[model samples]
Target chain A: MTSLWPIERIGFYEGQASAFYNVSAIERDYFEMWYFDNLGAYKSAAHGNLEGVEQGHRKMEAALESIGNKAREIRDISETERKAGIEPEPSGLWQTGAYTDYNREHN
Target chain B: MAAAVIYRIRYIVCLLSMLSLAVHTALANEIPAQGPFTDSECVSCHSDRNPELIRQWRNGPHDPASGVGCSSCHGSLHADANVKARKNQGCTNCHEGPASHSYSKSKHGVLNRIEAHEQDWRKPLKSGNYRAPGSAYCHLHDGDHDDTMSADRGPEVRQWICVGCHSPRYVREQFANGRRQLDIADLKLTEGKQLIASAANSQTKELSKLRQSLIYHRRNVLYGVGHQSPDYQWWHGQPALDGDLIRIRDAIE
Candidate 1:
């Protein structure tokens, strides 16, 4: 029968075989075949737990995206302000708590 | 005349309850005027609560000199002592430093604030109990569900986690106090993760080596993330397993 085992699966099967069984070649092949079938089951189970980790990663990504979007928007707004011939750059960058927030960039 | 007497009695009851409440608040905020019991009472219980903290305290330049106890940080008042006074006033009183600062900003403290409105804030802490290895209290051994917090059920397991960074004498003391078991592998993973977190948070030359070691540590990836390994790997005579050895090597060095 053809095996659907990938390279990673084959390596892991070898380790599992070495750890669990030290029988004849036929026995090793039988265990490897069993593991090959079981891999699908384990992968499905693992996906259940990975859902939360994936969600956490998405949240972190969202935070990064918001930061990037805000910076770009600020730059565009400043450029527009400059073209209008008002105060060269908007003082919003240096106003009030902006200086304290700037210090956050240094460390 | 009788109506005035009833009103006066009601006023007295309100005043007494108010006085009782003020006294409770004072007791909660008041520092212990005397040192804790020198006996192993603190260690006996706390060694079970947080053997890891006990281990750190033993070697952490406090044992031989001033001899800190569980009360030094968590305070001595039991839950039954007073309502709100049982929450650890001692640690906040003196350790207004980095750990306290970081902890206040941590998710645990935020959760604590939310829970403070409904439940007794000092329930577990007042009962000489500490949150377990994978508790939401810290990022040390946090597992799948972030909401549930569990403590080490075994005294030996608790002590074993402590001996990772503590001195031999302190380890022995902890072991004497119902902590006979030991596990180097578990301690290595727990401390290694904390080391990594500390290194990542603080940028200092002193933590550079720890950061390097933490970055390269292979077992860290699979240590708490998976099932069945941490428990059996320490107890059963199993060969050392590395989950992401190659990935860790590439990431670190």
Candidate 2:
């Protein structure tokens, strides 16, 4: 049986939904790269600079990559949910004002 | 010599009599019989006629003093007082001035020359279902209001729409004398100031006092017969007059 979760909501909270959601699909992205990178670290050790500066940079880069890939996945899921006449919960940086800058640059 | 003098005298008398006769004829020639209307002829076409305009005229200045009657502008309807006999010459018969000069320039008069324009014009004039209470329209148009016009004659006469007689330039004159009179005093600036100054120089005052009183008294003039005493005085009249006076002074300098 399919999960009875509500989907494709117009203005749902991003943090509460699945993280793999593309937040910048339609709106002007107002989030900067550093913002997305920092948000993805969540208070984990990966956010710290203990592993040398170069390693820290690499970790920050990886965080950005994860956020971006997760965002695309979320967007695809959203489109699918919408096509099926279900409203998926809003997810990703767009809802939470996280990837706003990144989205604006591309737009 | 005596015979020659007598002949010249007879010739002079004949000339004088001729001039007098012409004047009498001009004044006495009965207005031509017009369309199906007669005296009170408007009643037939305008049935259930309320003579509001006539009543106003009876009580108004035009009754006997101003020498105007309904028949003045609209002409007489001796035979048939229908609309056609009441041709457009009524107003032109007597009124001669810048008004007549300028009316020829106005769009209404210009457009009126076209055939059937009378029918087009009649729409607005007749559609209002308004019949003048008596002949107030005649009185108002002729500026035959009873009371001597003053600067502060309140709104009834102040808000008058004088574009019919005077141009916008002459409109400035009504406010000039500080009295609502549309006569010569308001029509000309020299006359306006002179009249006011003379008033102020009332038997009891010096020139300065006369000037002050003139300023005080002249504050009440109304620019038109309809709308705005305060707004007109402050925004349009006082400022415009003062500005005009300044320009005149500068030109003289």
Candidate 3:
């Protein structure tokens, strides 16, 4: 028989979820910076900078790798929890009976 | 000798009379007939139909004092006023100068190269599609057509005309903010730096190029030509563009 996961374990998963959210926010900024640099490179090329485009590409790849590592860490944490017989249940944070009832009534 | 003098005088009178008759005929031919409606008849008919247009024209610089009536600009008043006849030539007839000459050479005249590749000036050009002000836009704001009629006569009027598009706050709100929010659907940026990041991501290559071109035309060409203000063209325009380019470069790296 499978036992219910401890509250501390659930809290740990929630903490991991929060970290994932934070990482996503950082990734967005990183990608935006990459694009800005890419545009700068394009502008530079318009003038006479032959290597600007290649340099922009390299910087973008480095940013992507940094973001990718954080994503991998999230995946590893999830995988470890799954192996330990821990599964996420629908938390009251997202939905309550009020929303379901409202949807049901509207539908 | 007296007889010869009398004959010459008679010949000169005949020549003068013939010249006067030719001049009268030419003047008559120049004035086009207003279809079924006379000038007064036009006022009577359109007084109820499009009273506001009549009022706007009456109040404008083309008022009775200026001797520019409905027939002067609009040509012959047909059942449906023939709009094709009412060309920019009508404006050029009176407003001949460097300002008017530069208009055709300006970016506003050649808007077909921009987003509005197949736009017709006969109909109102859409506000969103318009990159720069044409004769119609400078004179008539958003099809109001009462700019000259309602304009305040002073230097401050330039602000009223230009601030419609040139204000950075207005541009950011209209183009940048909405586009940023829409482009990044899943991830929302609440912080100021993050919002700027989102905006940067949303910026397209085509749009950026178009905007840079627009700025060049607006500051360098349009403002100077339209207002005949040489100071703005050289002093303000080129420096502003240089500064903006540096900002764009620094924002990247």
Among these predictions, the greatest lDDT belongs to: 3
Show model 2 residue runs off by greater than 4 Å. A1-107, B1-53, B78-88, B115-124, B128-253
Q: Show where candidate 1 strays beyond 4 Å.
A: A1-107, B1-85, B88-111, B120-253
lDDT tens readout by residue for model 1, B6-120: 9999999999999999998997676433444444665776587667666755654345356655455444544333332233333356545433443454443444545555654
Residue pairs of candidate 1 with colliding backbone atoms: B132-B151
lDDT of 2 by residue, B1-253 (tens): 9999999999999999999999888866544334635545653333334455455556654564577755565455444322322233444466444333334333434444343333422222221222221112222333333422333455345335343334656555434433432221133234224434334233333434434433432332233222223333332333333333222222222
RMSD of each: 22.4, 32.1, 20.0
TM-score for all models, in order of appearance: 0.22, 0.27, 0.33
- Residue-level lDDT of model 3, residues A37-95, one tens digit each, is 66767777787886887776677677678668867876897899999989866443222
- The regions of model 3 sitting more than 4 angstroms off are A1-107, B1-36, B79-82, B85-87, B110-117, B129-132, B142-145, B148-253
User: Could you tell me which 10 consecutive residues in candidate 1 chain A have the lowest summed lDDT?
Assistant: A9-18
Backbone clash total, candidate 3: 0
Candidate 1, residues A4-98, lDDT tens digits: the string is 65443211111121232223222333333344334434554578756555554555455455546755765897799889886853332112121
Residues A88-107, candidate 2, lDDT per residue (tens digit)?
A: 55433122221223223432
TM-score of chain B of 2: 0.34
Query: Candidate order by lDDT, highest to lowest?
Result: 3, 2, 1
DockQ values, each candidate: 0.02, 0.01, 0.03
